[model samples]
Target: MTAMAAEIKKGRKFDQVLDGAREVFMRDGFEGASVDEIARVAGVSKATLYSYFPDKRLLFSEVARLECNRQAEEAMAEFDLSDPVAVVLHEAANRIVRFFLSDFGQQVYRICVAESYRFPELGQRFYASGPALVRERMSAILQPYIDRGELVIEDMDLAADQFGQLCKSDLFVRRLCGISKETSEAEIKRVVTGVVEMFLARYGA
Candidate 1:
């Protein structure tokens, strides 16, 4: 095989390992997942797994980031930055809430919650990789509104965080506590309307 083919194989193996890692991490949680199982599921040797990710924490960090980024991209695909502030925020809130409150998102959050005591740094890493990444994207998305003078914001990061938290609201807590499955389209719109209204009230020009 040519060097180019070898590089392509290596890249494919890297992605396979990441997919296996995500499955194991989601099913077993970070603390319960094993490197051996990850390697087996990935169809790679322990050496390959270690070559790609020296440690489970490193693998988990990247996995979290990738999953969160994937979800954010999916959500952002539906967003319209050129819309009015309320419309833009409403669309964003609906998509974001659906993703963040989905089963996969809850599982990821549960892993962080479960392993936090033993691997506290993992929580920070997860936050920086996942939530913080989305917040940065949100800041970028909101910039156009600011440029057009549709929004008056002192800090984009803070505004992004604020909007995210507002969208989640008590619904996330209720879901975590097993009292809600408020992720239906109607429920999402109901929740997001308030979030969008509140956010625009604060920042709209």
Candidate 2:
């Protein structure tokens, strides 16, 4: 483990600190979140919080990691790998679209973009925990179909990344630009359908 990872001391209150930090970070972003507020929200003393996370950046990284892992796992849990390629892609597309439009997702994306220049590690962690993890998961899901000669994907990584971006569609842009809030299920389905069909048209064998 790296020095930063080693410095993190997990204990009974470890999850408590992460949960509190997630809430504060989501609400206030990276720079705006305060150690005092995190400690207060966690119901732990400053010393206790510090013992678990020596720096606020470390705490934020941990929160983003856990949240991203949780989302990726949750999205994969319902997936039936045995299903048709399009069916599975649709499921993945739906989950990705919803997540991109989620408040937590938007906040994390904004924080990473805003703080990444000053704290490069912050952006690296976000990409590793979020986009990289999702790409790996997508590749895993697609591999079975490729072996069966159902999907002809020579560049699995690029295919996975493309699928993710396709899921964004107009909805992600509109939401990010404050053009829409509270997207309807019909709208989400519209995007998901388009992504799966387009992706399959390109890669399906």
Candidate 3:
């Protein structure tokens, strides 16, 4: 095959591996999932799977990374930092709730938590790619407001962390424990509005 054709084949194989890994991981948890199973599901030979991911651990980690990046992209895409604090906060909070309530989100959270005792690095990676990145993004958006005295935050980083926690805590916990049956649009609006009000009361213009 030509170099370009090889690259295309490699890309397609990677996509297949990711899809299969997600399905296997969600169904069997990290500890029980097998690379052979993933390869079979992906419709690729075990050699092909290994060509893309050396082992199951690397494959699982990549899946988490991709999911986190996808979520971050989605959250950041619609976000308009120039909006009023209330509007930004509302939109951000809604996005947070939506992500946590998603099936993929819940699976990723569970996988990290479940694998943390055996693989601390996976949990660390999850944090770095997921919540930590989100907090950093939030802080950047709020920094200008802080500088302008539109928001009265003494510790912008802490405020950003707290903002994310407040918006995601309830739904995240519920989903983590498998108790959250559904997340309604009305609930999202209420939670976002309430969190925004509380945040503003403490650190708004």
Candidate 4:
């Protein structure tokens, strides 16, 4: 059955299962988590769990996708796409990098990396939902700049990825390694300013 149709049949129960699964997966890791525990935590029968998510991989993928959506919304909720390009890019980079370097973000990143070896598809799912989503949204917002001759980007896809990676730089890696426990807004603003300057130098009209 289609997901919508399945949702219609299950309603909020499906969400409960997902919530339970997320808790279990995060706590136990993918290989260590058990479907039985998830069902118990969700307060649903095994049949209900199976009906909503036929397999562990599918369930895990959905859980990962939901978490990505949650973080993305939180990070970009107030984002305005119609601002001056420099301001917009700086704000976008700050939010994205800050979210990625946060404590919860590190936990989620480790979980994804740990599970990726066995279920490489989960890595792909996370990328598509997370970074790929940002790249597409940012590119869409910047296309008008190119058309208006405000910027000279020849490949918007590459440009979007470049902008995001520049924000990451050494910050995200150092955070993941526990080399730094925090990133101050002042630091982030400094980093983003340089990134914006570099980008403008390359793409300015």
Q: Provide TM-scores for the models.
A: 0.79, 0.88, 0.79, 0.75
For candidate 4, which ten residues in a row score worst on lDDT?
A: 1-10
Query: Per-residue lDDT for 64-179 in model 1, tens only?
Result: 87888887787678777877777777777877787678776776677678766666666777788667876887897899999998889998888999888887787787898899
Model 4, span 11-95: residue lDDT tens: 5699999999999987887777899999999999988998887767668777877887786676566666567778877777777
**Residue pairs with clashing backbones, model 1:** none
TM-score of 4: 0.75
Write the residue-wise lDDT of candidate 3 on 59-118 in tens digits.
777777777777678777887777777888888777777877776677677777777677
Candidate closest to the true structure, highest TM-score: 2
CA-lDDT, candidates in order: 0.78, 0.87, 0.76, 0.77
Task: Give the range where candidate 2 is weakest over 10 consecutive residues by summed lDDT.
Answer: 1-10
Candidate 2 residues lying further than 4 Å off, grouped into runs, are 1-12, 23-34
Model 1 score (lDDT): 0.78
lDDT of 1 at 167: 73
